[model samples]
Target chain A: MSLALSLAPLAYVACPECDLLLNPVVPEPGDKAYCPRCGYLLQRPRKRSIERTLALSLTGLILIVPANLLPMVGIKIFGNSQDGNLWTGVSALFKEDMWAVAVLVLLSSVLLPLVNLGLAFLIGFHLFMHKANNQLARWMHWYEHLNEWAMLEVYALGIIVACVKLAGMAELRFGLGLFAFIGLLIVNAMLSNELDCYFFWQRIAQLTKK
Target chain B: MLKKPLKTAFMQGFIRCHDCGSLLKSDPKCLCPVCGHHVSARKPNSVQYTLALIISALCLYIPANIFPIMSVTQLGVAETHTIVGGIVALIQSDMVPIALLVLIASILVPLMKLLGLSLLLLCVHYRWQVNARLFTRLYRVIAFVGRWSMLDIFMISILVALVDLRGVAQVIAGPAATAFAGVVVLTMLAAKSFDPRLIWDHQLSYE
Candidate 1:
C-alpha cells in the first residue's frame, strides 16, 4: 500500500450514536462499516456514488414537475367530477385561512423537496467535476439541514391515507401525479441513503489537495 | 478525588463537532475547522432551548386535538373531524390499519416525543444516573420518529386537494391542522435542540 493509503487508517472516528472512539478500517466498495458499539453506520464508500446519486436526483427533479402540476387525485361526488393537484390543496388550505397548514404543506411537500433534490444535483455535479471549493462545502452543509426538513415520504403516506378515507365517500381515481409523486419519493429516498457524508468530505479533501 | 476513573473524549480535552463529526480540542466558542459550525463540549443552552420548545409544543397540542382538523361537506351538510375524530371516522369506514397508523404516527409518536424529551430534560437537570444507555436509545427513537408526526398534516392537505367538488362535497382544512402541524414542528425542533451528550455528561460528573 502507498504511504497515504496506509496512513488513512490512522484517522480516528467517534461513533455518533454511542460516542465510542474507534479507528475504522475502510471497507471495500459495496461494503459497510458499522460502529461496533451502537451499530451506527461509520462509512460505506460506494464506487461512483456521485454519479448514481446525480442520476437519481435528476430523475426525482424531473418527476417533481408532474407531481406538482397534474392532479393528485380525481374525485366524483353527487355526479360532479373534480380534479385537484397538490397546489390545489395548498391553495384550499390558504382559502380556508389555515395559513400555518398551507405554509407547512408548501414548505415540506413543495419547496423543501425541490431544494433538497437541487442541492443533491449541485453537490453531485461539484464532486464529479473535482471542484472542492468552500462554496460547495457550504452548499453541502445546507443540503444536510434541508434533508431533515424534507418530508416527501410522509407526504406520500398522507396521500395514501387520504385516498383510503375518501374511497368510501367518493368515486376516487388516482392521477398521473400520484405515480409520479411515488417515483419522486422512492428516488429521493434512494439518493439520500446513498449519500455518505464522511466519504464526500474525504473525497473533497483529496480533490482540494490535488 | 474519590471517584472512579472514566474514559471520555471530554476528559481528554477533545470535543466532536455535532454537525460534521470532526474531532477538535475542547472549546466553548470555537468554530469547527472542517464545517464552519460552532463547536462546544456540549450544545450551548441545550436544556433551556429544549424546555422552551417542549412547552410551546405542549401548549399547541391542546388546540390541535380539540378544534377540527378538516371538515367534509357533503350535500350542504358539513361534518368536521378533529385528530381523534378523524381516526374514529377512519375506523367507522373500516380503514382499521390506516386508523391505527394515524393513531400511532400522528398521536402516539408526538405524545411519546414530548414525554420522552421532558423525561430526558428532567433527568439531565436532576442528574439522575440511572439507565443512561436506555435514555440515549429513547432519544434516538424520538429523534428518528419526530418528523413522521407530520403524516396527519399531509393527509389533510391531500384530502383538501382531492375532495373539492364545490357544492356536492368539499374537504376543507381547519384551524386545528395548523395547530397540529405546529406541534409536530415544535417537537421536532425541540428534539434537534436537545443534546444527547448531556446524558453522558452526567455520567462523567457522577463518576
Candidate 2:
C-alpha cells in the first residue's frame, strides 16, 4: 500500500483472465501465474510481439495516406453528385454550423490517427535500429496518452448515422476510400496486437543494461 | 496381489496434517488452516490499466462529436447529424430514456471514465503521495465500467444493418464512427500502458 521508489525495470507479471500485471516472478515454460484479485493469467509475453507490431504499424502507415486522400464514399442526388473524403465531411459540418461536431470528427478521425501513426513510426524506428532515445520514450508516453481520443467505433457509428440520413434522400455509393478506411480500422487493431509497450520497453531496458 | 495392495496403501497413505503439515493425524481437519498459503491472486496491471482506459476514452470523446454521426437522405439530397443530432432525434421521437442512454453511453460515460482514469493514473504515475488505497479502489470501480462506451456504437451498427431501404433507405457508416472506435481502443491501450507498480515504487523505496 505504500509507494515504492525503486525504479527497477518492470516485468511481465500480469493476470491472464483480466490482463492485469502481477509481481515479477521467474517462471518455467508452461508454468502459470494467476491474479488472485482479478483471476487473470500472468506470464512473459510472446517473443515476437515487437516485430509483429512493427510490421502492422508500417502497413497501417502505408494505407492511411490513401485512406485519407481517396473519397471514402460518394453520393449522387437529384442530378447533383458529390464526392466526400474524411476532411470534407467535417468541413461540411462546419459549413452547416455543426462546428463542435466537426472539430470532434477531425480530432478523433484525423488527429488521433496521425498521432498514433507518428508514435508507431518513431517507436518502431528506434526499436528497430537498436537505439534508445528519451525523446522517443516521451513520444511513446504521448502516443499512449493521446490514444484514447481515437475512437474508431464511435466513428463507425457516425458513419452509420450518416448513411441512414443520406439514404433518405441521396443515391449513396460506397467508394474505394470507404473500403480502404475499413481496412485501416482492421489493420490498426492488428498493429495494436503486434505491439506491446511494456514488452518493448522491457527489451529496451535489457539492451541499455548491456 | 499382496504387492499391489502395498503400493495402493502407500499411494493413499496420509502422513502429516494436510493443512499445517504438522504430524500424521488420524481424522481431523484435512485442509491447511495454519500457514494459509493459498495461492495469492490479484490484477496484473491494475494501476496501469486504469491509465490506459482513461486516455483512450478521452480521445474517443473528441471524434464522437467532430464529424456528423449520421447522414440522412431525403429525395436524393443528403444531410448529416453529429452526435448531438442523434440525441436530438431520440428526444424528438419521444424516447427520452433511450436518448439519455445514448448520450451517456456515446458521450458522458466514456468521458467520465477517461477523466477518472487520468486522475487515477496521475496519482499512480506520481507515486501516490496521498490517499493511495482510496484512489486505487476508485480506479478499480471506474475500470470495471469502461466497456459500456460500446453501447452507442452497437446501437448505430445494428441500426445500420437492420434498417436498410435499398435505394430509398440505405444506411452507411460515417467518418466519425471510425474515429470513435479508435478512441475506445486507444483508451484501452493507454490504460494497459500504465505501470501500477509505480505507485508502490515509492513505498518500497522508503523501506
Residues A1-210, model 2: lDDT tens digits: 011122253322332222222345433333444444432333434445656667777877888888889876666755656677676756655555545545666777777887797788778877777776655545665676566566655566557555654554567887787877888899887776556554555545444454
In model 2 chain B, the worst 10-residue window by lDDT is B1-10
Give the poorly placed runs of model 2, Cα more than 4 Å off: A1-22, A26-34, A38-44, A96-100, B1-104, B107-207
Among all windows of 10 consecutive residues in model 2 chain A, the one with the lowest summed lDDT is A1-10
Q: Which ranges of candidate 1 are over 4 A from the true structure?
A: A1-10, A208-210, B1-6, B204-207
- Please give, for residues A1-210, the per-residue lDDT of candidate 1 as tens digits: 132254344355566655666665667777888755344667876766788878988998999999999877888878778787778878978888888788988998899999989988988888878677776667778888778799988888887887888788889888898889888888988998788787776665455556
**Cα lDDT of model 2 by residue, B1-207, tens digit:** 001111111122322221121222233333322222221222245665655556555666677688876665544556677878878976776667666767877787667667767776676656656544455455565554455565555444433443344455444457776667566655655555554434433443221
Candidate topping TM-score:
1
The per-candidate count of clashes, in order, stands at 0, 96
**TM-scores for every predicted model:** 0.92, 0.53
